[model samples]
Target: MAHQTPDLIVSRRYLRLDCLCLLLLMLSACSSSDQIEQQSRTVASASQTVLMALDAWAAGAAPTAYTVDTLQSIGKTLADTGAQIRSAETSEPTEQASLTKAVNDLSVAVTRAEAGLQADDRLKVQDAQQDLRLASRALATAYAKYFAPKP
Candidate 1:
């Protein structure tokens, strides 16, 4: 067999390099998607916590301080995720849309929870509870549709 020329060897090296670069690119893309999905789950779980708080409040139980605190913590997580989203340079479509939807859903749920806290009326509490549950369900559905692994 003929020995390969130096130019042919150099060319082969670059072709492998090209393949390596492409594989890295694809993996990074997939990782970004996974991050988005994780972020979406955070938002959904936070929304669910808010809903749970509303339920406790409406059931005539003393306001759920733990749940309130959990919701607040989740709010902080969402805010951080928002910053990540704004700073991202990737062109991943699904993750971008997922991040946008998560933020919107969490914002609405938080607003409702804040309103409930501000209200002195029990009826207002009930209304806020209903709103929180509805919003949480919607957010969860969206996340599940886009990112959740199949059961």
Candidate 2:
């Protein structure tokens, strides 16, 4: 049996500690990647919902021909999508906040459109439509900022 020197014992302990740290780092990185992937899927799902609602609204046989019920339904869809976006977890706090704000703005615009439909006010509806377009743009920007491929 050989007696190990103090330096050898210290070196072995240091190597073990280094290995532990590396393992923890790898695990954290994998967790982060999984989180980002989940967030991307959530954003894609919400974006699809918004786009579908927009398409349905635009598919009316005639321009400015959406019924009150249709407007209400679209508004509800927008609100629900916003809720989904809000519930998604993101690695970027700033981007998450921006996306949340954009989604909330879209929901508000849709609500206004629904109100306009209920009031039979074409001007108000048009204004809300414009706001919706802007909100959509903002949301797209935020989504890209957070979910864009890293070079």
Candidate 3:
């Protein structure tokens, strides 16, 4: 039987250390990729939601306008909700609550906007249309924040 020298044992230890380092690096890379993919999926889902709302509006399936105060309130809510979604990208809490708020606010806004369809208030309808467009744009912005690849 041949006896192994001390140098050989030290060399084996070094090799083990290198392998451990490589494994850690690979794990880090995988985690980063998962984060990016998750962000992309979130953005895509949000886009789909916005598109559905817009389609419903275009098809005359929803209200034409809302009471002035309701419109303003919903618009403001949508705006704030959008900001929160974007902020989630960098915020420590991940802004889950904010994203939920955005979805709920958008739902309410759609309801209010669609409620005015039978009133025949063209000007108010137009205003609601503008607000809806603004809300969609805000959603797009928030989506972009998550989906856009790092520069």
Candidate numbers, best lDDT first, in rank order: 2, 1, 3
Q: What TM-score does model 2 achieve against the real structure?
A: 0.58
**Estimated TM-score per prediction?**
0.72, 0.58, 0.41
Model 2: per-residue Cα lDDT over 9-119, one tens digit each? 999999999999999887876675566545545544544554455455546533344455555665565566556556654457787778778877877877787677667
What is the C-alpha local distance difference test score of each model?
0.66, 0.66, 0.52
Q: Tell me the tens digit of each residue's lDDT in model 1 across 52-151.
A: 6666766767455654566677667777876665455555556466557657666656665665565555566566666666666665665566564645
Question: Which prediction has the highest TM-score against the true structure?
Answer: 1
TM-score of 3: 0.41
Candidate 3 total steric clashes: 5
Off by over 4 Å in 1: 64-67, 85-95, 121-131, 144-151
lDDT of candidate 3 over 25-107, digit per residue (tens): 77765664456446435543543454455456556765434333444444455455445444443422333443444455455
